[model samples]
Structures are given as C-alpha cells and as structure tokens.
Target chain A: MQQALQQKVQKAASAIAQECFAMRVRYLNRSLTSIYDEVFRPLSITASQVNMLVAIITQQTLSPSELGGILNIEKSTLSRNLDRMRKAGWVEIDSSQPGRSHTVQASEKGQALLLNILPLWQKAQETTCTLLGSERSKAIREVADHARSEIMKT
Target chain B: MQQALQQKVQKAASAIAQECFAMRVRYLNRSLTSIYDEVFRPLSITASQVNMLVAIITQQTLSPSELGGILNIEKSTLSRNLDRMRKAGWVEIDSSQPGRSHTVQASEKGQALLLNILPLWQKAQETTCTLLGSERSKAIREVADHARSEIMKT
Candidate 1:
C-alpha cells in the first residue's frame, strides 16, 4: 500500500516538474529573442520581421496569401507585419490585383539593408548554436517545428 | 575536388533548411497565439497575458521582478506585458520600495473572468495534447524546458 501511494506521489511530482520546465522554455525563447532584437535593432528590424523579410527576399515576389502559406503565419499577422515594413519603405506592396490581396517584394533599399544585417544576424545565430550545441539545438528546433505544425493544423 | 564541393554545398543546404524550419516554427507560434488571443479577445487578453495571469493565479502576490524571473521573460518585456495587463484591470501594480515595481494580484473582476475562461483554455490544452499524443507532447515540453534553461545561462 505504501509503495503504491509513493508511486502516485512520484507521478504527481514528475508532472508538476514537467509543466514547470515547459514554462521556462517559453521564457527562454523570449529572452533569446530579446537578445536578437537588441542586436538587430540598429538594423531597424525586429527578429520576427527579419525572418519574414528574408523569406520574401528569397522568393523575390509573393502574394500575402502565398507568403502566409509558406511561412505558416496567419493572413492577419503577416498583413500587419508587411504593412509596417512597407510604411518603413523596406517593401513594396502591389495591391492592384482585383479580388486578391497585394503581392509583396522587398525594395532595393530593403535588400541592401537585409544584406548588411545578414552577417550580424549570423553572428547572433552562431552565438545561440554554439551555446546550445549543434545536436541539441537541432533537436530543439525539430521538436519546436513538429509541435508548431501540430498546433497550426488544429 | 568535385566530391568535396558537393559535400560543401550539401552542408550549406542543410544549414539553410534548419534556419527555414526554425522560422516556420516561430511563424506558427505567432499564428497559434493569434487564434488564442482571438478566443480570449472579449476579455482583452493576449495569449501571453493569459499565460501570465495563470501563473499569478497559481502563485499569489508575485512581484514584477519575481514574476519576470519565473516567466523567463526579460524584465523589460515583462514590464510592458504587465503594463497592458494593469491597464486592462487584470493586474495590480504596487511597489515594495522606491523605483521598484510590484505587480501583486489580479483584480476581482480579473479573477472572476479567469475562472470562466479557464475551461476554454483547458479545452485548447486538451485538444492539443490529444492531437500530439502524450509521449510526443511531453517531449515537446521537455525540449522547450531545455531550451529555456540554455537561454537562462547564456
């Protein structure tokens, strides 16, 4: 009887510790993002925005729907993010297509700015990868990717 | 020479793919958060704020510094998140001493509203866990925890 009770208690404690750790992960991501954003701030881009800009630049031209589809970002969030970038003169939004949203492409200035920021971004990425190690960092990215895919499909 | 060049190109491709996957993960998290925020919009709470509220409800009278520490959020980010929560009347601001900010507890209305919303939040959690499976879901959380600890030390 005592052994069974102890087993139950152990299970409860394990579950509690697990949940506690998960919350820590959220903060860790936020903190790391803070660091990247600080470094990228001089470039006049947010870490999230830099990711989006790099995507758009890679494609050269993409409709909002297409961009959202590729990035797994919501139509709304991408729209707002793109709007900010546009207003900042970093992207050109072509909204002339009837019954369809605008297609977005980075401006020449935007591309130049992105080129300047890429090396800095790489430095930030290297710091994180070095800290986390290649295997563990890749594993965390894989798990986060899988978990994110699961959530979006919901 | 040709074989070595091929291997170098393959390594570059793999590196790009890893960055792509990480960006996708970040985008999905942003989108999933938008959905959760929409669900709790009437309450004027963002998903992260809801998470903070849940943390506070679980632990009474946590200061902003202490709460920031627990959340793994930067002190500045926590301050900003707390500002909005305070404006929404979901959290109270106090001070233990000069120039120190203490976010003590939720308002009565905030407390009552959280009780009502808890079920909806739990439903989301249950559905996600069900979709991901217990083992994979647990692993995701564990990896997230590991990531958080890694960031904390860095």
Candidate 2:
C-alpha cells in the first residue's frame, strides 16, 4: 500500500510539472518579473510597483478596493504594498474623501519616480517582448483580459 | 517644461497600462495564484509550496541552487521559502553529501502532504484551466518552455 501510494504521488507530480496551467503561468511570471526587476533595480522599485504607480496616477485616485481590483491583488497583499509605497513617499492617502474607505493617489515623488522609470522600463519591456515573441505576448494580454472580465462578473 | 514633462509622463502611463507585458503577467499571476491559494488554504500549504514540494520529491534531492534554477526563484526568495518549509516539517536537509552545499529532500511528511494535496490541486488546476481557456493555457506552457530554454542557454 505504501509503495502504491508513492507511485501514485509520483504520477501526480509528473502530471503537475508537465501540464499545470498555474505552474507554467507562475514560472513565466517569475522569469519575466526577474528581467524587469533587474532593470529597475537602480531605481529601487519593482515591476509590480511600477504597474501600481501607473494605475494610481492614471486614475488620479482610487479606493484600496478599486486598486486591488484593477491589479488582482488580495486585500492583505495590497495593503502591505500600499503601506510600503506610502513609506517610500510613492503614494498618499486622502482620508478626507467622503467614503468609509480612504482613497490612494500617487505622491509627487511617485510621479517623479515614474518619469525616471520610463527609459529603464522601456529596456525591460523590449527584453521581455523579445523573450516572449509577439504571438505569446499578445496571447498573455488576451488571457489577462479574459481573467479581468471573469473577475468582474463575480 | 513642467507641462511637457507631465504630458510625457501621462503618455507613458497610458502606454504601460495598455501594453506592458509585465503588468499583464503580474496581474494574471496574482489572480491565478489567488485561485489556487484559496483552494490550498485548507491544506495549510500554498500553491508555490506545493510546486516546490513536487520538485523536491521528484528529484529525490537537489541543492538549493538547483531547485532555484528549476523554479526560477531568486536566492533570497528561495532561502526564505525553504526556511518556512523546513519549519513546517515539509523538507529536510541532507548534509551528509560531500559538497560545499547541502542537498534538500522532502521529508516523509512532505510526501504525505503531496498525496493529500493532489485532489485539492486538481480542483485548483481545473478552475485555472477554465479561467485561461484551452488555447491560452497551451500558449502559456509553450511560453514557459521558451523561457526555460532561453534561461538554460544563458
């Protein structure tokens, strides 16, 4: 029975390694994030942070939940990142807004940081595009769009 | 000059929101990871930990660097995860080997955890596959393979 269980587990492991969608997406995510992170290292900001800054600045202001929805970040994770960004002067909260939850917006420093990040981000983007090829790059965007739509439905 | 800089920054932000591959990938990664994480919550293991466990058990043993290479995890991140896994009694180190680096292997408890995780993992996998759809799912795997080959070359 023990031998049988081990064999079954091995089979399962092989299947997951070969065919799991989450595993592949996650692996690709890690690889791509590392590429961008390396390029953005001098700025002391990560790719995720850059994405957040862009979203915040573009929207002018957003409640935490709205930012979380746009980025697909969970509440706890989003809160932690926002706190870090606030400490870094990358974002500020507007508690004066008429709502139960405060709104977040990019601070002046954050806007300045994004300006500095543009050239470096372009280099990282070029590298990632080259790595993924145009076809897969397009496919990823489609998948993310699908995810967003599905998430909105719920 | 100030107006020009703001315009340029706004343009950059809009472009990134629309076309940045890293932004989309990171968003999808967060979304998909949350799906799997919610399923694996009962198991007290995360999707990432499950991935690490499978890799560890399949190889029977691997050095920290080797595991990191396979998972595309950075050294600091890998070390931190491993520390957590070790504390959880899921993996153990075998320092008996003749090398500067110690080898890591899943403990018996880890193997049992995998057995328990298989069904839960399948549920998460099916949910993710449904979310990504068949075509994008296959594309993600292909992209991951492309990334792996490129990384191996470097």
Candidate 3:
C-alpha cells in the first residue's frame, strides 16, 4: 500500500494543487492572526512577537538556536526577528558568541506587554474556539498535528 | 452542546500552549512553505509569493480584492503582494474595473517557472503524503475542508 501510494503521488506539482489542505489552514490562520495583530497594533508588536513573548516568559532566557528549534523557524529568520524584537525593547540578545549562539530574554517592557495582552489574546481565542466548537477544533487540530509531523519528517 | 463546550473547555491560552488546532496547521504550512521558499530562493521569492503563483494559476486576471477573497487574505496585504508580483513579472494586473478593481494573470515567465518547479514540488508533496499515510492525509484534508467552511461563515 505504501509503495503504491508513493508511486501514485510522488511530485510537488501534483501536491501543490491539493494545497487545499494547507490553504484552508492558512486562511483561518490569517483571519485569527490578523485580529490579534490588530489588537497589538498599538503596541507596535506583531503576532509573531507575541509568540516570542510567550517563549521568553516561560523560559526566562533561551539561546537563539534553542529558540529557533522551539519556534521551528530557521536560525537566520529567528536572528532577524530577534534583532527586531531587541530593537523594539521587547527582548534582548547576548551575541558575545561570534561563531556560537547566545542566550535571549524578554525585556521588562516585553514582560509587561505580555501581561497586558493576555486578556486580549484570551478573549480572541475564546471567541474563535466558541465559533469552532471544542470537539471540532480538537479534531481539526489533531489532524493538523499529524500533518505537520508527517511533512516535517520528510 | 456548543455553549456547554465553551464553558467546560474554553482554554484558549492553555490551548495555544498545550494544543491549539491552528498551531499544527500553521506549523505544517510554515514547514511546507519554507521548503518551496528555499527551493525558489535563487529567484528571490518567498513562500507567500509562490502561493500567489498558485492563485494566478487557478484564475483569470484578478483584482486585488478577488485575490484577497480567494486567498482569504486582506486587500491591503494583497495590494503589496500584487505590487511585488507585478514588478517581478510573475503577474500582470489589468484595470478591468476602470478605477475599481484590476484583473490579474500570470506572465509567460511565471507559467514557465510553474512548470519548472513542478518536479521539485512533486518530490516534496509525495514524500509528505507518504509520511502521513495516504488515508490519513486524505481524511485530514477532508476535515480541513469542513473547518474552512466553518471559518468562512465565522
């Protein structure tokens, strides 16, 4: 069965059309993410920054490589993002390691913003979940997880 | 049941941390998107642009608003994206609406590249579906459709 399936669907072009799997997810993500992004607009922070805030808050400090792994983003991209976060006073990076990675942490301002945005995030999350229904959302998420793991492994 | 679920399991923050339906989808998207993005790196296009390529492949000359709807993205974001696409010669936008909306279409170059990338995309997609199992990928995509419909109404 595996061999047959492999033979039948073994091209990126063929899968690109079937991107409906990813497209719907992308659409919903944009919708929900845009709302949170708007809410954090006044703070000059992006929803991505919020993810950074959460990570720093939980770990107190993490090296960029570790942060990249946890964030599942490329190190270069993470470095660039952290550069912006550091400039915004949302986080700090210790770049003493010219060749090696260093630790990163949220700033005082960043931590405060997290507390401030917690309720807003909660409200938005609650509303969307309610609309999605817990059972339905859970099932969708489970499938998404399986999909993510499968794609990442390859 | 909806109301009860909301009350019983309205765990948005925890969900984002522990398990959010969108995270896996978003993760898979980011991962899959990054692969294509990296593949097209020499062309200097991002995953989002490759995604727009898919949009152009699907429809006739589209206005920003039309692309926004099909992509489930906002017009403002679409505006910037279309501008980039136009500049890159990947798309051409015609003022079909006479000051209202513009029609968009892929260029010769874009079509050629699409055909060029087909083989690479095939390998990526095939590997992913195989990793996920054909039945699992198919089942998950069906559920994604349901979730997308649910979100569109929301």
Worst 10 residues of 2 chain B by lDDT: B93-102
Per-residue alpha-carbon lDDT of candidate 2 for residues A24-129, written as tens digits (9 for 90 to 100): 7788888888889999999999888898999998997889999988887888888899899999999998878576898999887888888899889889888988
Model 3, backbone clash pairs (residues 3+ apart or across chains), number = 9
What is residue A63's positional error in candidate 1, in angstroms?
0.6
DockQ of each: 0.18, 0.67, 0.21
Which prediction has the highest DockQ against the true structure?
2
Best by TM-score: 2
CA lDDT, candidate 3, residue A10 = 34
| Per-residue lDDT of B5 in model 1 | 44
lDDT tens per residue, model 3, A19-70: 5344544666676676667766777777777776676656667898877766
* lDDT (tens digit, per residue) of candidate 1 on B30-133: 54455566666776666687778766766657887878766677688788888888888887877657776655786665666665565555555565566546
**Weakest ten-residue segment in model 3 chain A by summed lDDT:** A5-14
Question: TM-scores of all models?
Answer: 0.72, 0.92, 0.73
- Report how closely model 3 matches the true complex, as a DockQ value: 0.21
Report lDDT per candidate: 0.65, 0.86, 0.65
Model 2's C-alpha root-mean-square deviation from the true structure amounts to 2.1
What TM-score should be assigned to candidate 1? 0.72
Model 2 segments more than 4 A misplaced: A97-99, B97-99
